[model samples]
Target: MSGRIPHVIRRVGAVVGRLSVYVLIWAGLALLMATAVIRFYWGEITVGQMLLNLVSVETDGGGGPIVWIGVLAIGVLPLLLTVGIAALWQHVRRRERRRRGHDVRPRRSQWVKRTVATALVGAVVVGGTTAFATTVGIGDYIAAGNSKYDLGDYYVEPSVTGAEHRRNLVLIYLESGEATLADDQLFEKDAFAPLKEVTEAADGWQSVADLQQTQGGGWTMAGLTSTQCGVPLKGVGSAAGNGALHELGGEDSYLGGVTCLGDVLDEHGYRSVFLGGANASFAAKDVFLGSHGYSEVKDLSDWRAAGEPEQSFRDDWGLSDGRLMAHAKDEVDELHAEAERTGQPFNLTVLTLDTHEPVHVYDYCTVDTQNVVTSVFFCSMTQVAGFVDHMQEKGYLDDTAVVIVGDHLKHMSAGDAFHEQLDHHDNRTVFNRIWVPGEDGNSTLRPRVDQLNMYPTILEAAGMTLQDRAAGLGVSAFAPDVPAGSAQAMAPEAYADLLGSRSARFYAEAWAGGDAAR
Candidate 1:
């Protein structure tokens, strides 16, 4: 009976045992990982955003050690778990045979186990499929294809009009900058207070009251594109061929079809530049920036080449915020001097990294708050405040318009900080403060707006006038007019549906730079 059982296991039982178990474990894990990824990338990461990241990973390395390690664990741990599960099954069966005092382990029982395991595997796979489809909003993705409003219908060719004298631009992207962090009633303390104190309205600053991170606008690339290009960033639609993704991924351009902030600024003779502590290639940001119109792009490699010490780095993500801000001050000094000498305006865009999650505590920060994350946020704001103060001291603010904004709202992953109190909070928003030269304390922005409006707002703040005070899907918050049929003019539900839809043909042209009509 034992010999017969070995034969049965080798050919028949083995098929269901190892193969089915492996499938079940992997399928289960994949579901969990998908949920985790969504949480890590703000409240949700749409399918288009996932496709963009897939392209980004293939083109460049898959970002830092933390991201890569997570990927590796997903692939590797399943194999080990499957093997262990198989071993346990064999041991239990053998023990039962010994207890029976004969080679009488029934083949019928073995068949039953195989049948059960196979059924379980199938169930898991089907369940995972359903869950994944729901998580990514497959229904909405399909429905969007037929939606009446298309991105093309609303996209305005971004342009700066009527500014005889262009002021310099100092755009700062705060990492995971949520206005909720300012709610002292909820969290331990206000992390944004230092920066807020420096940018007070009496001190010649103005702010949009409820700056939102729009649907499909949570990730860095999406945020950057929305705020700069005045449109929500999306990947190729499912209706497009696989070759379409390949076409979009190439060095040609990111969103080449539309004229973006960089494009308009370049046309208007503003010297555009970007500075960040991470690898710009992580999301093909270099391609996006270069193709759009930025003259200079600075990332980790450039800093390394410039001889930054290895000790200054963390998580293999490059320099700490402290060091990056120091370099930023110097950069502003040089740019300010150059502008003074050449009479050309400049845009020095800066992105902070200290508050990015999987938070790290720098030596400069003292963790006084209950949550280390909040303390780090406070420290980061202090750094930004110092930079703002330096610009003030140098009299650079006299002509430069400073816009400090969150790239996106804070993500709420399982391991992330601040989600406990924030998880149920209905009114989460991004933080922002704007400083325009010679503005009175009385000037105010529209009560509610999204990142899209920042494009024209920034342009207008730098003394450029828009024809309708509008561009892309957004109208300037600094201006009161919401053009008929503009996103701002649409009903909330209707506007959301527009964002959720694929807009396949429109994005195709937009990605290829073929739709220049708007």
Candidate 2:
């Protein structure tokens, strides 16, 4: 009985050791596979961007059934593959042992040793591959410095004296919108035809084919900050002891010392309100907007409080584009009336949400397309065009400068299927259209512009001039005085240096420090 007990104990230990090995193998393989998938989808995933987003409340909450399904598929496939390979390897090893007349029973000591060796090898492989991939993808940006550019002192301040008039500003940030939306070559059907027609026919509208993203310009919050402040949003080196500006709170001042378009408008006595179909709290948008001088930041909670039907909150994101557009029209009337009464120019910024991830199409989406995402894309564009038409019909276009731009390039998750249709989806461009009250088609054409250029371009479109027609490493692409091959033409390496510089870090930290002090 004692001899049988020893054998049973050894068998149980061996089984346990093998099981532990299986878990380690699965984890290691999953890490490698996950990195590959993320790289494929996002091109380059940065540590700072990941940390910033992970800390945000919105990161965990959003996305619907389709998103979860895709996530599960991505997550489960590697695990199953690892298990299958392990099983096959085990079977082959057993067969060999039996053919050689060796002991078929697993030895506890051998199993432990084999498992440790396999786990160690896997760890090394995973670590090496991850390091290499990150280096290739985002290392340049992370190691960037601004020594060559001397952009540390570069700052943009709006000069009301240089302006012909303070035109009312209607800035529409289309969520994950891109030029590819209108590309008939990219999609089986064009999703942005209505928008294209509107921009083509409208005078004073400048449409740019190439609007490239900078280091921090790929994500939504970073895109918004870059376009608005002419600077990239960066995280602090450490958030260990900061009370007010801790990891979660520090995002508010990511562009702290940098002056934004909203600040300029506010200083010039312009009333600014930001309306969005999603939670303004998601990226601390409300805080960012408020700190930058927006008076009212209306978001999901506001819509619900104002008696928006509970059914309308169907999307993972708050209101649908159609519903938001409808609500925006009413808000436009109120703002316009208030502007008329107070004689203050108003800045109405609307951020659409229907085109957000999982590509939820509202019940009102009538566009016919083979892909549900395409249908949603078309429907969102249609809604935007309709709003523009509404503004024109209501006489808001006469004095208002409508600046329509994608907050960022279309998120890769939103275009997984769409990418399969396009010949080359790399370096995808975001859409940009600047409509002044009375001007004809594309007076000036540039080959390409960076996201930072949009900051000064918006002011230029509003008939406002900067002190030097440049702001925060950005020269207005529309400004005649802007020298050719300015920052807009900077090489990717130079731009990365600028993003990774101490000056950029200082600016970010200053913002965080100020927030912490407060």
Candidate 3:
């Protein structure tokens, strides 16, 4: 009866073990399939590409079929070996159990019992650790918490204030113009010499932090969008989509997602221009530009007759920043005359192209990929300097409240590490600075300002009335009492609300047939 009981117990254990195996296998398969489907459809992963990435770690080099087969083999090998080892160990333990009493053990090392006891203790410790981990909701909770910031904390409600100097706004969104000092070593680096010289000489050229685009990357469209829209590129939440730009002439879509500086300027009867080096058609540019109230747009097709070469198109983009500025200078001159005739200030925009990615050509510096990307950043600064010089020569510098800033910091390139053993605090944020012409000496503003606040600053500088609370998000250098760190710029959600409210108002007005085009 004792032997029969042992056999019955062994049989029951085998059945339970097999059932657990099947259950685990099914659960794993279901989880894999669900993840695959999500990645395929909503995440926009193609069938072929999905399989390829699964089988091959990187598709950069060749070996398509073989690479995939190797991937499968490597993934499965460890599991198979583990299973085999477990089965063998179980078989040995079962023999020992059958041969001896239920409490029987195999011959082992001197410390084997102690080791097993320690492992059991370790398992208890691991179980507690796992419970704590699950309770904490570790990584995702931390990230989401960090991204959250309150507007009330930063923007205290205050009264509206008036300003002087209502000049025509000409915001030249010079592509990638980071206000950095020039370096002597690199070529193609002289672009920003004009800005450097001017800022150095002028006592009023104040600098603030760079505009941080949401993703820390360049889409050109995103940069322009953030600049004009005065919000981070992402999280436009619940905004209207005007329509497709494929059929519309010029800009086809209504840029409803962002609160635009254009609408504000347009409210003041300033005709805004959206000009750039990228094609007018690229990446919803036409719709974003048009819907955001750019009265005139000059992209690649517009520059065809400017005697720019077919190979100069090999500038691998639209027009050079230098060329774009020259064209913009001409456009500004025309708009100035027209504004004089109509008694309306012209809002000119020249989105420059030269200092963008590949940072190949600048007036002063160039960098090899082997060096740090900040080496190339120096090139962008030089280009800005040169552009500023040109603007000054053409009288675009005087009395015109100019705002030049980087769309975002340069993303560090691969294999190019900043290996200096500097103090940890010294290497914190990589955002660039904002340069407000003639507003430098104001002590009321904080030492650090962010990118999104730039829109209000421009509006305030150009003589628009802003609430003291709204102005808390920004400071007018022209204002007598500027509080240090009084305004800390918009966080992502507040920024979203700011943009959405303005954009919705624009759409609502446009729908009602009042100031829609404006």
Q: Number of clashing residue pairs in every model?
A: 1, 4, 32
Residue-wise lDDT of candidate 2 within 261-302, one digit each (tens)?
Answer: 888888888899999988787767777898787999988878
Clashing pairs in 1: 257-513
Prediction RMSDs, each to the true structure? 4.0, 6.0, 11.7
Model 3 agreement with the true structure over 290-382: per-residue lDDT tens digits: 666678777776777677765444245556555566676677778767876887776776665554444444433345445434454554445
lDDT of each residue in 180-274, candidate 1, tens digit only:
99999988999999899899988889999989997878778888998998888874774255345665566657777878888888887889989
Q: In candidate 3, what residue range of length 10 has the lowest lDDT sum?
A: 55-64
What are the Cα lDDT values of the candidates? 0.81, 0.70, 0.48
Model 3 TM-score (2 dp): 0.55
Which residue runs does candidate 2 get wrong by more than 4 Å? Answer: 1-43, 59-138, 145-164, 238-247, 250-254, 413-415, 422-427, 481-486, 489-493, 500-505, 513-518
Candidate 3 ranges beyond 4 A from true positions:
1-164, 178-194, 201-203, 209-227, 236-258, 362-383, 413-444, 469-518
Ranking the candidates on TM-score from highest down gives 1, 2, 3
